[model samples]
Target: MSETNDTGTAAPAPVSNWNVPNALTTLRIVMVPFYGWALLVDGGDSVAWRCVAWFIFGVAMITDKVDGDIARKRNLITNFGKIADPIADKAITGMAFIGLAIIIDTWWMWAITVVVLVREWTVTLLRLSILKRVVVPAAQSGKVKTAAQAVGLGLLTLPLLEVDGWLDVPGEVVYGFALVILGIAVVLTITSGYEFFREVWRQRHEIREKSPERRK
Candidate 1:
C-alpha cells in the first residue's frame, strides 16, 4: 500500500524494501537457541565454546541494530515487524539470562530472569490486545531497559572467558557487577511495562466511553 506524507505528496510502494529487514529479523531469532546451547548445555569449561558463544551474542546484538536501521531507512516497517521484533528480542535475551543462571547456578539470576520474562510477556499481551485500536510505540524507558539487559547479559557471560592470572580482578567481582546491572534492568523493565499498560488502559477506557452501548 502507498502512504501519503503531510504535504499530500504520494509515497512510493513499500513492498520492494520490506523483505530484507524481515530476513535480518529472522536471523536474529535463529541465534537464540545456539546461544542457549553454547552457554547452558555445553559440557566442560572449554574456553573455545565460551568465545564462540560470546561472539554469537555480539553478532546477534549487531543484527538488532542493523534490522531496525534498515527498516527505518527503507520504510520497511510492517505489521510482521511490529510483532516479530519484540518476540525475537525477548526470546534471545530471556534465554540468555536463564542460560546464564543455569551455568552460574545462582538463585538471584533465576529470579531476575523470571522478573524480566514476566514484564516482557505482559507487555506483549497488552500490545496484541490493543493493536487494532492504537499503536503502542516503543518508549524511551523501554529502550533503556533493553540496553541495560544487553550489557548485563554480556557481563554475565564474561566469566566464560579464560583469561590468565595476569588479569587483575576476580571473576566473582565481575559477576557481582553483572548482578547489580541486572537488578537495575529489572526495575526499568517493570517501570516501562507499567507505563505501557497505563497507556493501554487509558485508550481502552476512552474507547469504551465513546461506544454506542455507553451512550445509553
Candidate 2:
C-alpha cells in the first residue's frame, strides 16, 4: 500500500516495526513495572532497593536515547515509533516522578509532578487528535525538558542521602540541585506545550484554507 504525495506520486513505503528501535522501545515499556516495583515496593527506603530502582531507571533512559538516535540515523522512522516512542518515554519518566513524590511525601513535589503529568498527557492527546493532519516534530525545548527530567529524576531516584557519608556530600545540596533541575523541566514543559498548540492551530488553519469549500 502507498500514500499519494503532493505531486500525485506514490510515497515511500512505511518502515517495518521489527527494527531495533522499536524493540528498544518495547523493552523500555517492559522495564517500567520493574522499575516501579523496585522504587515503591520498599517505600524507597532501603538503600539496596533504591539503587536497584535507579539502575533500572537509568537503563530505560539510556534506551530512550539509543532508540531515537538509531531510528533517525538508520532511517527506521515509522508511525509506530513516532507515536509509541513518546508514550514510552512519558511512561518511564512519569512513573519516576510520581514514585519519587510518593516516596518523598512532599506536597510541592507532588504538585509539580501533577502539573507536569497533566501537561504531558494533554499535549500527547492533542498531538494524537491531529496526527493524521499534521506532523508535529519534537522541538528542541521538548528534548531539553526530557533530558532535564531524566537527570533530575535519576539523581532523586538514587539513595543519595543514604550515601552522603560515603560521598562526603551533603544530601541537602544534592536534593536542592535535583529540585532545581526538575523546576527547569517544568518551565520547559509549559513553554513547549504552548509551542505545540500554536503549531496545531497553524496547521489547522492551513488545512481549512485549502479546503474545497474555502477554495470555491
lDDT to native, each model: 0.79, 0.88
- Which lDDT tens digits does candidate 1 get at residues 1-216? 569989899877656434887888888899988887777535525556666777788888888989999888977898888788878887888878777767766777678778878889878866766468966688999999889888888877665245557453576577678778888889999999988888878887898999999999
- Count clashing residue pairs per candidate: 0, 0
Poorest 10 consecutive residues by lDDT, candidate 1: 159-168
Q: Residue-wise lDDT of candidate 2 within 1-216, one digit each (tens)?
A: 789999999998878989999999999999999999998876787888888999999999999989989998999998888788889988998899889999889898899899999999888877766468888788999889988989999989988776646564777688789989988998999899889889988988999999999988
lDDT value for candidate 1? 0.79
What is the C-alpha RMSD, rounded to one decimal, of candidate 2?
3.1
Total clashing pairs in model 2: 0
Q: Which stretches of candidate 2 lie over 4 Å from their true place?
A: 1-14, 164-168
Error of 1 at 155 (Å): 1.5
Q: In angstroms, give how far residue 108 of model 1 lies from its true place.
A: 1.9
Residue 107 shift from truth in candidate 1, angstroms: 2.1
